[model samples]
Target: MTAPGNQAVTMNSQGTAMSAGPQPAASAGSLRSALRLWRLLRVRDAGRSDPQRLTGVLAVVAFAVTTAVLLLVLGGFGAFQQRAEAGGPYSDEGFYVVLAGTASVLLLVPLITLGGAAARLSMARRDERLAALRLAGATTSQVSVMTVLDATVQALAGAFIGTAGVFALIPLVLPVTFQNRPFTYAELVPEWWVFALTVTGVALVSMLSAGASLRKVAITPLGVAARHTPNPLHWSRVVPLVLFAACFAVLVHYGLAGIVVLVAVLAGGFALLNLLGPWVMSLVGRLSARRARSVGTLIAARRIIDDPRGAWRSVGGVALCTFIAGLTAAAAMFDSVGSDDPIVADLSTGGLLTLTIAGLLAAVSTGVMQAGGIIDQRTQYRALHLAGTDLTVMHAARLRQTAIPLLAAVLIATAAALVFMLPALGFGLLSSVPLLIQFLLSVVAVCLLVLAGNLASARVVRTVLA
Candidate 1:
């Protein structure tokens, strides 16, 4: 009986030990998860603490807010269209509202591009920290998650602020009349779900862009340590331009069915331009490289040839603005052919406002991107400075880099606009002084704004080197 009792005691002790061992393992896992969360929070806190990183966040936020505001305005125009279709006072000219709404939607292109630029800028600033994180045993996936989290946070904050901005703008927008009628706040304000969707969309875009930008660093952790040269652009990019031309020819021969077709063509043309713009820059760079007489010009040309996409990203908004100006000018000329319809006047005003917003956003994006490039290349800049290279030469190279692509964008956009418009507006429209003045002024204003923005980044270079 004593032996049997000892055996039972031994069995119970073994069972208890096994149960206690599993509990500690479970506790260890939970602790690990908690620690990960803590580390993520710390990483985010560190980003916030750095001024350059914080600026990047702010830029993302500002872009998000701007996008949200534009979306809200689009919703308002949509609402106006619906009301007009319901036999509101401007029922005869309801299509104007629709056109305006379409223009507003198209404006999203620049906003999206601006957001992307800001995200890339942010990531560029964080490259070293990300490399450090990788060296410290953080997995690639973990670093990516952290980047997405940072972007999502900034986007969410921007969305919230943008929502508030919409509300704030309501009073200001109320006084502005379209077709001589005021817009009620209810008509201008979007539904809560729309705002929710806007926030979600912005967050998703930001996260995706941030993640995409990290692909290089994620693949080769060492890639973050140095910049890699981009691959040469192929000739295939010309396909879009050819396709657009063919489509435009067909549309013109048959005549556009309605405003819808016109809008579709315009939008499609712009999309093709987006694809072709970089390729064109590449060609320009190559040609400039061949003829480059000075070191600054050669450096600028080579830089653009190497990364035409980057160069285009900085000036793409200006190109879009140029297109808008051309279209608006042609419309103004067409409207002048007859009586100055209040609806036409209103449409012109809306177009001008859209162009202005686009130009401003372009300026901001250019400044942000330029500043980011300066930050990313600070070491190289310092080395160059130490090697007796005049900083002024570098500045000149940057200016030339910007100017060449910019000139190409403006010329292409203007030519495309005239091609599309001349078919509908007739050649007589070209002689309209008011139309010419408006168009030229729009181009000049946008150019000045872009230059100013680029100049602003020069101070950033000085600060970084200091």
Candidate 2:
């Protein structure tokens, strides 16, 4: 309960002096101590450690991207609402409202996932220092609180930058017309409360993710270590896929009964893809390893086989984005049919917009996850370099690790999406050159974006090895 200045040499709130006899400290008292410790080490750690600096930069960048995108998506909601109000209760503005809502739902999960990736990366980069505190007598809750506090600060900075990002992006988007007219900046802006809520949500997700990650690890005097192996992923993951297929079939068998049903099916199916992704990843890894012809491929395959969940985590956003592309590209294809209706014309623009935004989400999150993966295995990478492993081979292995799951996930998701749409579009859907072009363009763009993400982390490998 005493102030930090009371002791000859002040210790943290826990009174844990790293001595054999350490006194217990209250949680509230730990805040000053944690802040003091953080300030003392921040400069030294940033200056001395490559990973420390990189983690901070990545965390801020990720939070900023997440926030900016959240605002952009929310703007669509607000724009549609404003348009609806201007129509005096008798316009097809409601139709656009439904489209905007659906697109927002598709993008929301990936945005939060990106924030978690940022938190996970930032939290991990500090494990050594945190474990040192644990050794010096900090309790689990204390270390966790410190971790959350660290993430909260990073999140706040990121959100501020992200708001700025939205302003910066507004001019670029101003030329794009919806409802036959371009949007003013004011029209694109959401309600004032939306900004506050989004910033708070981003911070909360970061803190929660950082605190939760600590629970999975055992930080002791010895080192930062994970506990026993997690229970293996179960076959029950397939349940989602089955449920998705059944729902899709029902929507197809019946008719265009309701917008609510369509959104529910789409959202449910998207959620299920995440569950099915890891299991599918494991299956792909096992099969590819058996047929591997090169050392790089074998290593990559082995990695996926060992931790398929982590493998999926790296590429899940990209896969989900691909599904979005598959679902929306049909609307764009309809434009090629030369429909005169303004709504039909707008569908093309909306579809392309959805694909572009989803692609951005995939790219940013993939880069962060890839960087974090490399940092997590820096020691292993160093050992491989020290051994006879060639630089080319290491690079090859890293590329293969991402390339394999990304290819499988995209192809399967696209195929599933196309199949679900068959009840509506029929064989014509598959045969349309415009749809084919849209899909191909999306695939190429996604591949390029994913490759860019992988390339961004290539420097991180060298940093880790050094």
Candidate 3:
């Protein structure tokens, strides 16, 4: 922010901007400048409401979950790679290593999504802070730096907590054996540089996510006041997914020709599901809103239609995990192959592990997202509560919001997994009793995990409304 015409702006050492009549502004884009601005803003927010404080707390917890899971996933990958290269009699020829890599790849999307969500958790508060900084004669660069710095500090705090969490988690994992050998803490821990890298990566992710939001919000005070409707999701979002599906079918028709192409297509197809998710969610919301016969469903559908991107973010992890579970749910059919190889048995273990962790990630991420949503809409909720509407209806609405998209996402993902795998595994596997049991258990566990995540926010809802 700069002086225009006769007005003046200056800051005391305490960081409060003063009407000191024309004076020089603080240097912009410096770390010191950003910290000073942060302090000034923090002071202004010192008297924040409980809901505001809880929002910050929830964001930090989300960051901690993200960091801890990241460390575990990377550590697990390193352990398998190290064990696979040891040239021992216990080696299954890098089989477990491949499984670990698959799990890591599958977990990366949700982990990063959680990180971004945590960074931008306090959206409404942040916009006000940004506007306040601009009013305080801070430049855009200074405001941007402060935003990133604020997110980085929170992530750093969470990273430390997450590091401590890893130690506790290692003991729990120690009891579970892979290849008849339980993991020592030493085996599960990554190298020191791994921790350093994880911290740096998290900071970078937070910064980038913050930066992206900065672009969306204008820096001017009036800009903050302006309300712009979110643009409707374009049909272009579905083009890539449709094309990918077409290519997949073409290959499937040719008796699965071009094995390398098949592998690439399969990987690309899974990626497209994520691309297609929000669009499908928006479509679901639009349709459901029209057909909604009850207040709960109507409100839930409207919320999704309002922010389909967010709607997907809350449940997207489960949708993807559900997709993975759908494919692996039929793993029991492999046991009937009657092979002497221990590798066959390990498949079930690996699938269960992947589904379990995925569920946990989805649960925590959903909880954090829902808590944040409650804080964001606290104003509306309070108004409604005062108007004699029951909070139970609101709670039911939120549950529907999560449940409906979850059903759509699961259906889309399951159909995709079945179609892709059907060429190789055939319809016979779907009919196998053991396969049905394992897959059903996997799906139920994930749904239960996500339901648990959604429920985690119920406490937050109560707090906000109260």
Candidate 4:
């Protein structure tokens, strides 16, 4: 019944169906394309055309170096704690070491915040490239994968550099004694597994952060072109502040039994501050915007109101440093009176070390955040420059943006430190001029350091303009 040609066509169709059953050729092509994409990402030219990409890489490197240093410092503290726990001449100091370790660990927040800022800044800069990729037929998953891979590469490079930094720092750290004994190089240097873990941790953090940043844009390619306005902060933000106050009250009521409790409470309080800071900043911004008497002030206030979270990220670390400085000052006064106590002397030293480390890290964080901000806003900055806006005015606005929040942070942290210290030291402790001066000088120094860091970004602005 069928024509001869029809039979030939039926046989061809059956062969075609058999050949299409497994799709081996299509799968292999996909695998090959993925490999090619990976190779392209590994190529230097992939990042060379984009200056922001280079800046992001540098930020990651800086973050890794700082993280490595922090981990080493923490390792040294752990060694001291271990020695104290062994029950010898240092047994009395074990609690102090434990407290110090906890404080050091708490410092990780600023570092993590700085890393997040960097990742966000990096993502902001890549919006155009991402959109282009999407337009060119890359699926959202492909774009997300590419971003994560980019972050992972940068993080891996940074971690390796950071490891070298750790080795270099060990010699410098070996001479510093804690608990009446210098740390052995071995004690300061973490184990091989720890180093490996650090590298892995950094890479994972970078990958997750980059991936999270893409969530806003990955679903809809057009989302990359649209800016989402952050909602106004609500009353719920006050809960953290209230919780912190309660914790402090409990500690004040318990007194000496509260030292161990105080450490945990202090950590919680700082974390709460992180939550409350942006809200407070938003409130301040609104107030300042209403009272603004100049163009610079108006611009700065509006900027803060628009992005309070970003503003806080640049100064939160300094606020913590200010608190540490205040606490150290109070501790030093106690040490002066209790000269006979070796434990008090050791605490004073540890507190000063903590202040120094915190301040240094804060300075670095401020600088990195500021620079990243400049890079992220370069287009606007350039447009403003072309519009004949005075560079000095822009500079002043930038300073004001940092200054308002920073002043508030220092005041809040210092007040809180005083309140906490008052239960331990009577009102008479406030009359210690030497300790007060020392604290004031330390706070001023840290603020100046942060200011310098922020100002350093002006160079980036200039570079961008050129």
- The 0-to-1 C-alpha lDDT of every candidate, in the order given, reads 0.72, 0.76, 0.75, 0.71
Residues 336-373, model 4: lDDT tens digits: 87587767777777778777777877777787777777
Tens-place lDDT per residue, model 1, 98-208, is: 676677766876787787776676676556665554444444444555566667777787777777777776776577677678778788877777777887777787788
Output the number of the TM-score-best candidate: 2
lDDT, model 3, position 238: 81
At residue 110, what lDDT does model 4 achieve? Answer: 67
> Candidate 4, 125: how far from true, in Å?
1.7
Model 4 steric clash pairs: none
lDDT of 2 at 17: 41
The prediction achieving the highest lDDT against the true structure is 2
Task: Kindly list the per-residue Cα lDDT of model 2 for residues 72-116, writing each as its tens digit.
Answer: 889878888888878853348588899889889988767867887
The model with the greater TM-score, 2 or 4, is: 2
- By lDDT, the candidates rank as 2, 3, 1, 4
Worst 10-residue lDDT window, candidate 2? 1-10
Rank order by TM-score, top first?
A: 2, 3, 4, 1
Candidate 2: lDDT over CA atoms? 0.76
Instruction: Give the Cα error of residue 304 in candidate 4, in Å.
Output: 1.3
Query: Candidate 1 clash total?
Result: 0
* TM value for model 4: 0.87
Worst ten-residue run, lDDT, model 4? 3-12
